[model samples]
Target: MWQIILKRENEISLSRQLFYAMKDMILEGQIRSGEALPSSRGLAKDMSISRSTVNEAYDMLETEGYIVTHQGAPTRVKEGLYLEKHQKHHEEALFPVITLADKPYKVDFKTGQPDVSLFPRYVWNQMMYKSFEQLSDKDLGYFGTAGYESLRVEISHWLFRKRGLSAKPQDIFITSGTTQALSILVTMLSKAGLPFAVEDPCHRGLLEVIENSGNSILGISVDQEGMKTALLEAHDFSAVYVTPSHQFPLGSILTAERRIELIRLARQKKFYIIEDDYDSEFRYVGASVTPLYSMDKEQVLYTGSFSKTLYPALRIGFVILPPKLHSEWMYLRKHLDVQNPIVEQAALAEFLNQRKLDKYIQQISRMYEKKRKALTTSIYECFGEQCSILGDETGLHLVLKIPGAHFDEFFIEKCQNAGIRVFPIEHYCISKGNHMDQLMLGYGHLKVEEIQKSVSRLYNLIMDTE
Candidate 1:
């Protein structure tokens, strides 16, 4: 009799467990090739299981070619299936343990996280449920890579009404977010062995996309007006990446003269300008600045994201491409990720069509305005004219320039040990020593009480270091 045991009350079927155990033993070479298996009746009697269960397990093993049986003969293990045991040494392999959730911080000043508490979850859930109930069988199947057509049409109308930019639905290419849009663009547009020009101290993630793609980068300087286009005369580039509406980290609006100059340079040099109009909808000033795309549609690839205005988990963004690049972009997108989920796209289309996005942005804009005011006042009270704030007119975060103070790695560690979290401006720069005297503070996610306490703690940390 075979040494087979069966637990009849196990959650897994007895036949499945028996088949797995026998298969594993054969694969591991514990059961030698050509070894005869016991008969179902004998094994069943030894294991105290029904004869039918043992027969089913043996049937599976025979079906899988693990064992061979002839008419009225015993089952024998198949030969030549043993794999040599060459154990791989993973001693040199390094696995990263750091994750976003594991990041240690007390007063987190992380940027780009919207206040989730203010999100209209009830309305969003209703729309989502409605979309699911109304979805056709066609929606569940593989849609086109460009996106759901209804969403594209709705987005076109939304863009025209909100930003005054006339974008056709055919020209719009949907992506997961601004990051993926930029990533795909870098792959598609970058010329072989050519350098790209990017604004110095740009969003580090975007800059990384260019660098990791092996495209040489020309770091054009920027002042209060954004990306000094005068410096472009010296170097040739494949394209220029810019944040025109509201510059990243620095928050300087590109001037009209510079916008014209940039377009002229792009045409003269035969390169494109990537206009990242992120967070333009939340402008706290007079009117939303006209995107650089307005000056020349053909030369600019405009990208916009809903992460800031809407919840980040929405994972929706779009790129408005000119007619010439449209075909290539579509091809690249089809091969990369196939397409976004249809359910979210369908729901978002309904949301945009009903003008829910418009009302949502208006409500959140007022909340952010109040938060911005609270942060500004708190900083003034804590530092008392010793520190100056930069780029407070718009966006979720601002830079605090402490005169004669250098916030380096040493200072950052000390602040962390004291439970204060802030980013040094130098952390985002490609060239060191340029912005060592400033710290970046994100107040969008902080409440009035939390802002006051965090600012006071940060101010005290600076004083103690000095």
Candidate 2:
């Protein structure tokens, strides 16, 4: 009799377990291909299982083409079912698999991280459930890759109301995030032997999207007004990438004059301007700055993400493409991921249609403003006159500059060893020797208590180092 044991107490049916056990044994060559299987009655008697259970297992095995039986012949494993036995290491996991969970940091101030605890998950979950229940059967099948149209229209409405940028629904297409948008953009914009003009000390993740795509980068220096638009040379780059609303890492808004200069340069050179309007919402001061895309939709290819405003795991963002690039973008998108999952898109569309997103932004914006204040106050208390905050206005994170304090690679390593995770502005720089006196502090995810304690610890660590 075949040595097949079934756990009656197990949640899975006995027949399923027996079938899988036998199938695996056959595949692993434990039972050779073409080997005769024990008769159902004999297996039942040997294993002490009911005859019906063994019969069901045998029937499944036969139905699946794993085994063949003639009216008068014994049930046997099919040819080519045998595979080499896989070697197992004792050091490797064999029992119930255990997965490692991320260890909680004593003080985590990671950038672009929103406070998920404050997100209106109950409402979102309800909307998600509703979308699932309300989505028609046809709506689930082969939906166009351009994204849910309702979501695109909602994004268009949001841009006008929130960012003061007017884009038609046709111009706005959904994306996973800025990363995917950039990934597709680099391919479309790349030209032979031409470099892309990117801000020096930009987000590392963004820098890679261009570099990893085999495109050369033109590292332009950034000052108080974001990328030094005055230094940008026309007819040189394929496209100029900028975070106009609020700069990344350095947190400076591109000046009105500079933005105009960039648009003119792009128009003259026949190049495009890739505007990454990351986290334009939640401005602490007056209104959020007008996006460069707002100036000229033809020249500026706009990208925006909800990673900061909503929870990051949502993985929803969008790009505004001019009519010229629509077909290629659709083709690329169709093959890329073939569109985002319909449920989340539908839920988000409902959320926007109902203005729950508006209410949520209002709630979280206040919390972040408070957190931003806590960080700045703690920094002042800790370092006093020694440090000054960089960047104009608002975002999730800002640059903390202690002018005299030298922060280098060794300093960063020391902090890591001390269980403190802090990123120096230099870490994100393409050209070195500048901004070494600064550290990037992201406070969006931190509570006031955590911010104060972490800033205090950070001060002591800096003091010890300097």
Clashes of each: 0, 0
* Alpha-carbon local distance difference test for all models: 0.86, 0.88
For model 1, where is the 10-residue window of minimal lDDT?
A: 87-96
What tens-digit string does per-residue lDDT give for candidate 1 at 264-292?
99999899999998887887878878788
Q: What is the TM-score of each candidate against the true structure?
A: 0.93, 0.89
Off by over 4 Å in 1: 1-10, 84-100
| Residue 39 shift from truth in candidate 2, angstroms | 2.4
State in Å the error of residue 311, model 1.
1.2
Off by over 4 Å in 2: 85-100, 129-137
Worst ten-residue run, lDDT, model 2? 85-94
